[model samples]
Target: FGTDTANQVEEALKSFKQANVQTLVLDLRDNGGGYLTAATDILDLFFSSDEVIYQMKEKNSAAKKYYASTDSKYEFVNGYILVNGNTASASELTAGALQSEKGYQLVGTTTYGKGSAQTQKTLSDGSVLKYTYAKWMIPNGTCINGKGLTPDIEVENVSLDGISTKDVKETLKVDCVNTRIKSMQKMLNILGYSADREDGYFSVATQDALKKFEADNDLTVDGEYSQNDKQMMIARMMIYINNHENDKQYEYLMKIIK
Candidate 1:
């Protein structure tokens, strides 16, 4: 804001550089509700202008690009975001900027999926009413409104005995997961879902495997895959490909199952 939010951020970053603070944690919880333009501007520091920081969608169609400024150069490294369940509005935007744009380590949980961007429209009654106008999507062309961005890793808020039993730590390497999803031929080869060899990337063999999984689970096996189905597919594959390396393959697998 004109009141000095941007400068404060700059100053903070400068201070971090001067202080040489390692393992920085940006706590953006319980503080949100902001102007859309401002959020996008701040996003510039962590992403290039060519990057589509986020998008605006009116209907359920593909999002329209709300691109970053091309003249801007933002690259943040070694970032850790501490987001909680109660965070909303502009706060969510900040967290999303870090997560979607920078791919920072998210250590709390999933975020609120309020996709529609809102504005305070002044009515004839001389009163301002909040009206939702457009939904928001990340630069990668993924919607983040009704469906919040899932964490690359899942961790809990509470822990004891220097260990956590109350929560599940499911670490998701973006590339590895996607590799596993896309390359279904390999999974099929090993699982005996088909006689197809693992060529990496989803082909007819992968789709067929997905259908079989859905049929077995009594879930609707639509050739068109998705997030829930993707998770299910990966879980089944995990049983077979336990802690398998080859990140590209993993990413392919994640995408197909998703």
Candidate 2:
């Protein structure tokens, strides 16, 4: 959320209204969250002035309830929020509020589970300190600090889900045993190649899968995973996800909407 995000959402809602779009799917995947006021502003679009958006509990102070102050511009008969493990803070707040108050269903995976509010202060020594001072909760008064909001409909995107590739340092070949090999094996298996195992060991089957991928992509027929091969695999995986050829979560959402 930013200063302009609410404005953009308002404009989008206006367009949707003009187009007679009655249902809404708010995609909040990988949103790490931002300003609280921005979130409240966006929530104001879907809630009335008397509705409580969220509650804040600061140290040694009574919990304060924040209410929406504006009328909703558009009312959807059905609404869903698409979230993932990376959705945090204000994103969780918005999702939780809508889910609790408006009966909106949350689709996709669990959220990132960050419910604290933080502030920063500059000291006299020219240093800055940032720290969490308060906790926020949904309208039900349940704080989702460590436990993320569970999805009403759980859906996993298996084709694009895998271990991180940041620690892949060296070239991987048959007989290599490391996390990189495991990550590569998982990717290859998800991409429809038979890597046989994903236990961090690069077997002959893994080598063969690599070779097949290389041959299919017009690369050298080497049964090894180099940095270039990793890059190519990531690019291809991105294209696959971007094309949405097999988005199970989205498919389920469409089915439910129909």
Model number with the top TM-score: 2
lDDT of 1 by residue, 52-143 (tens): 77767786676688766756453444666665555556556767777766767655557666667766888999999987777776666676
**Backbone clashes, each candidate:** 37, 0
Cα TM-score of candidate 2: 0.94
Q: lDDT per residue, candidate 2, 1-258, as tens digits?
A: 998999999999999989999899998988999999889999999889888999999999988998899876468889999888998999999999999999999999999899999999999999999999999999889899999899999998763455555744677888889887888888888788889999989999999999999999888889988887888888777777776567777878989999
Best by the lDDT measure: 2
In candidate 1, which residue ranges exceed 4 Å CA deviation?
A: 1-3, 20-23, 60-62, 70-76, 158-258
**Candidate 2 accuracy as lDDT:** 0.88
The alpha-carbon lDDT assigned to residue 148 of candidate 2 equals 89
